[model samples]
Target: MKKEKIQLKGITWGHTRGFVPMVATAQRYEELHPEIEIVWKKRTLQEFADKSVTDLAMEYDLMVIDHPWTGHAAAQKMVIPFDDFLPETFLEDQRENSVGESYASYNFEGKQWALPIDAATPVAASRPDILQELDVLLPRTFDDLLALAQKGRVGFSLLPIDVLMSFYMFCCSSGEVPCQNDEQVVREETGVRVLKLFKSLADHIDERFYAKNPFKVFEDMTQHDEIAYCPFAYGYSNYSRQGYARKLLHFHDLVALKAGDEPMTSTLGGAGLAVSSQSKHIDVAVDYARFVASPEIQETLYVENGGQPGHLRAWKNTQVNALTANYFVNTLPALERAYLRPRYDGHLHFQDHAGDVVVHYLKNGGDERAVLAELNTMYRESLAWEGVHG
Candidate 1:
């Protein structure tokens, strides 16, 4: 009699960084365990961010997820908690070495809903050769960045989602964290100040960039000499790798709001690995998840195959830093201080619409107070949803 074969299907966002490593790891895992085979698929980035975990859980054995979805996943039991499946020591190591709040972001209601496999936050990127040719120093302050934008040398992602994340960055940098209260996203005064600051910068850039995302901004930077610097974008290590693009990008921590202040806090963005509760082969899925997230694998195979690793060891690996032109070394501080977004069951509802409100205020120059009021209404409604749904 022949032995039975186990097959597991996984879904991740479509990107070289997002999709490639899973395939690499799956291939490696299959070689290590001949009886088990893993197949991976991908969806668009927007779909990855907005799609419900419950829907994906029903079809796939493994899922690459946004941390914010953990709250909903836990609430709905869409994915099994790793605490019950993975070893305690492994979980402790993940917590200690997490990039910023990456590990904690996936823990909701006292359950470990997922294991962080990748980590990122917005960081500054520049074309060093272009800057040298233009004789421009990298912008060190908010005003310097504004002046560069005024010269049409700075490119940034201004999509509603990016704008909203920047809104959080400015609010937090200015000593007021947004969405801390049930009734408001931030204090009225802080919201107004952030909006004004954001608009002043946005006013200087080309209007066409309003539709671009971070990936597009990076592509524009490397493909043309027009963009000398990008003030901030969710850092992608691929651009820093040699031969990955036409021009190599030099990445670093964000510029200060002013000359003397500390660098700003960016909103955390990364993908987590979770096993579906509906999977037929739970043990094999858990074992595969561990293999992918283990420190040795994360630092070696994962990063080598186009991954931005969640493990701190990978971030500190000298060879890994060399491979990406010190991208990990330079941006790790920003990641360490990045703001972790809310993970309540209903926070996604607020996240989905709040960006549009910020984008409107940035483009239309409305009463900042009205913007705050609208955001507050959303916040209150989100909390009410938790009450009814939680």
Candidate 2:
């Protein structure tokens, strides 16, 4: 009697640098479990944003979903909770800090919808040689970043969604809630200040220098050496693995507001694996999910393939440590402290509105008060939809 072959199909959004390691790991898993055939369907983040999971669920057995999508997916009953299928040992072996207990970013409504596949923290990537040529110290505050932008040598990238999230972090650090009182009063006081800061940076820097896509910023940093420093999402150890090797780009942990301001904070980002509720091959999918969470696979795939390990233990591997070096040492601690975005089903809609507000304020030079008022209205509508105030 021969064992039956299991074919697992998956869909992932975002073409971030993290994909390399995941694809590599899938190939390795195929070698080990010859009976398991894995097929991956890739989609741009925009394509995923344009469609709902319900429309695409039948195409893939496993989906690499965004953190914000979990609530919506769960509400639609599109994903299966892992508690019923995954073994206790599998959960026990996961990096304690990286799993549900410590990293609560991936959990919602007391159920774990997905296992974190990679970890990302926003950091500043700079051309060390350019900085040395300019003889400027690493920026330690948003004010310092503004100064760098003013020099007309260093550039800043403008990403609407990330900038809005970063504004949330800034406001929270300042002890102000952008969405306050169970989403009743949309407080734009803190939001306005954050946008003002961003506007100042934009005004000081050459508009031509702002890159819309982060990958373009990375490429410019490596190829043209034009940007001295720009805020970026971390976990690109794989990109640095080749070509320039050790000399290309340097990673700086996030910058705080000021010396006395709260510690710098960022949102937890990157993809995670979720089993589809509609899949008939639930057992095989669960096994594959467990295998993805294993330390051996995480270590080999994450480090060799350029994906950031969602397992804290894998982050401690000697090779990974050497590859990431101080970058991880300085950044992972921050990721541990990072906060998650709103976990409501309408998170995407809220993010879209917030992003539009940021972009509008930056481009049109409006009073932060008006923009924030509009943002608060949007948040209220989103909360109404989710039935969760605030």
Candidate 3:
């Protein structure tokens, strides 16, 4: 007697980079296993970041999730750890070849919660043709960025979440990391300086960007000609690929704070594949995740289909580089040094709300110290939920 076919469903964020590869891989997987079928659905990018994993797990067999939710996933057991199901040798290979901290970010409480299928960080992007036509060099320092913004040629995403990420970047660049202790996000001195620096550029850029995210900013840049340069946005390889957009964007490292300082450290932004604990077919889900995250698949089908692969093999693959105009190679350094966000159970509370506080200050020119105090309050509240909930 023949076995009955099994079906699985997965959820990923909406976007070619986030959605297409999963669909392609699922189709291929079904071809390889005639007894199985996989369907993929997508949510808005913001929803992908904000939705509760536990809720999603109830509906899907697989989830593409942000690393910051690992703590909650681990505490609630909403997703099973790959460590118990995947082979040690395979896990070891993932660790050895991880792009920066990509592999490590999903391991919480000593168990691998997810397999990083993509890796990204904010990197500089520009339309080389536009920059050349304008006879302006790409900005290399803070002052240079300000000068370029003054000319009304720079594009940046200032959405509340983006504002929070930028605040983290400025905090780190100013020689302090945010959310180090339970008491505060950062020292008042560093927080104040970072906000002031942020305000300087926020004051200059076009006001329309305050409502945009990286996707919209990239769309405006590629579809229209107004944005010649974006100093920092999550690097989207699709924008750089031939025929993927109306115009090609060349990506590069971020500008330094000073002429001699190191490139700015941006917040990490990527998605990982996790098996839902609620899945009826746990073994099948894990198998599919492993196949998707494998180097051979990631370097070839994944990248070719618009996915920004998390595997280092893909990052260094010549064919992958050729496909996306070396987008991986150009932005790898930023991913390597990217600051990992806090994942302690309730950190999402802060991630969700703190951005509003930062954005408000940037737009209203309020007291920086007061902003820091409010952020500290939020930080404490997030920490308070640490061990209390799933």
Candidate 4:
């Protein structure tokens, strides 16, 4: 005789890559453990980026979360700290093998809030067949990228969040990092240069990119014959895999900021699995999360089911690369050097509004001096939330 199975629910982003792998893994986990069953629900990718984890934790036993939320979640005690449930030995292993700062990103206020299941950053994506048809060589330097943009084939996600991230990228490449301290976001000169560069590139590419997210950009590229390359958008491994789209797109690092060196760095973006502190099924949820993130499961079942893994072993696995057209290996360097966003409890408030300031400037003409002043004001106001109550 057997007892009735336990049921658990989860929330994750809703995309073929975002939603499918978790469902597939849950099916297998249930098959192996007849005592438990897990169901996953989804919100849009933009919502995934924008939602409040404190609110989501109340509704779902498990959550797929962005790393930036750890600060607020930790402060509010809205989610279970992985360090409390997962063993130190296991944690040390995760820390040692993290793809870029994937493992560390989840650690805030000296506690681990989630298990990194996917690791990605902006990298170059191109349709070689289309580029070859147009007789344009892929770009290698910032100057080359601008030259190619002038040819009217390059496109990248120009959504506000992405524009903000691109601003950070150009700011970093210009020798000043954004939000280095609580009081400021970027140097004035660097902000001006980054905005000017973005406007210059936007001048050449189709205006439709302003509305496209990374997934949409990939979809449009596969559906049409016009765009040939994207210098930076969050990498989606599915495009590199066969039969996942209308056409396979090759993934590689970004064009260099200068001649003969590492490719330009971009903002880090990935998803992790976290257990809601409110869940009655903590043990079961933790077990499933551990199972989903283990290297063996990550390299084989997760990748096979369309997940981009956060484990370094998966990135280095030859078979994984063979299946995904070397997307992991070629883009690994960029991820390893990717820039991390600020984790202050009030950072999200800034992110939600600050991006639009840049986007507005990009689309409609605005004074660069005004934009810089606005960002600095937002930065100072956000830091005040550190001590003030809601």
Score each candidate by Cα lDDT. Answer: 0.92, 0.68, 0.92, 0.89
lDDT of candidate 2 over 195-229, digit per residue (tens): 77767777765555444455555666677755788
Alpha-carbon error at 257 in model 3, in Å?
Answer: 0.4
- As for lDDT, the candidate ahead, 3 or 4, is 3
lDDT of 4 by residue, 274-331 (tens): 9999998999999999999998999999989999998999999999999999999999
Per-candidate TM-score against the hidden true structure: 0.98, 0.90, 0.99, 0.97
Which of candidates 1 and 4 is the stronger one according to lDDT? 1
Once model 4 is optimally superposed onto the true structure by TM-score, how far is the C-alpha of residue 66 displaced, in angstroms? 0.7
- Cα distance off (Å), candidate 1, residue 28: 0.4
TM-score-superior candidate, 2 or 4: 4
**Model 4 segments beyond 4 Å from truth?**
none
Q: Write one digit per residue (lDDT tens) for candidate 1, span 110-184.
A: 889999999999999999998899888988899989988988999898887788888899998999988887878
Model 3 Cα lDDT, one tens digit per residue, 1-390: 988889999999999999999999999999999899999999998999989999999999999999998998999899999999999999999999899889989999899999999998899999999889989998899999899889888888999888899999998888998888889999988888899999999898888999788978998999898788999998899999999999999899899999899999999889999999999999999999999999999998888899999999999999899888889898899999999989889899899999999989888899999999999998888888775664
Q: Model 3 off-target regions past 4 Å?
A: 1-3
